[model samples]
Target: MFAENKLTEDFGDIRNFLLSEREKTLSEAEWRFRMRGYGYNLKRVDTGYEVARMTTQQVIGTLDL
Candidate 1:
């Protein structure tokens, strides 16, 4: 397991990087806008990227159900 302090430090580093790359990074709203073109509703998953919702049926089908 990762230590809490280490995790905090890592998150701070990532935040700094994002701040430095703000102009290049896609905001949550922008990502959702792009995903809407593909008929997907995307939301920010974490401090990093966006994610789209998936159904249980899709997961099961993908698993060869």
Candidate 2:
């Protein structure tokens, strides 16, 4: 149950990050760099999803406290 909660929270954080970044005027490379810094990789999939799991390990780590 805890893992489920964590996943949900992570998804929310990811979505929020994407929305906020969309408002910025960043180049593709810069945007990917920023997302990587937050433990996410941005990609445009055929399903309309814009996030891709590029690394098995979280580069920026988790935010749990």
Candidate 3:
């Protein structure tokens, strides 16, 4: 019975983690859209993605920076 309870708790933790990660990803995507409006080229890469901002000059000076 204790094992079953532990398993349920573990699953709940996982669900929470997934929900938070999804919210974070959505936020990043929204930010990317806003950046694009300002002549910024943004691409979404899903593998261990980290949110960052590039200076306008940096973006203009490089193809991939």
Candidate 2, residue 20: how far the Cα is off, in Å: 0.3
1-65, model 3: which lDDT tens digit per residue? 01222433243443343344445555756745644443344454454332232443332211122
Please name the candidate that would achieve the greatest TM-score relative to the true structure.
Answer: 2
lDDT of all predictions, in order shown?
A: 0.35, 0.52, 0.38
Stretches of candidate 3 off by over 4 Å are 1-26, 45-65
Clashes of each: 0, 0, 0
Residue-wise C-alpha lDDT for candidate 2, range 1-65, written one tens digit per residue: 01212554365566656556655746767766766665566554454445655566323222221
Residue 13 alpha-carbon offset, candidate 1, angstroms: 29
lDDT of 1 by residue, 1-65 (tens): 01222333243443343334444547746644644443334344344443232332121111110
Error of 1 at 8 (Å): 38
Per-residue error for 40 in candidate 2, Å, reads: 0.4
After best superposition, candidate 3 residue 45: deviation in angstroms? 4.9
Ranking by TM-score: 2, 3, 1
Where does the lowest 10-residue lDDT sum fall in candidate 2?
A: 56-65
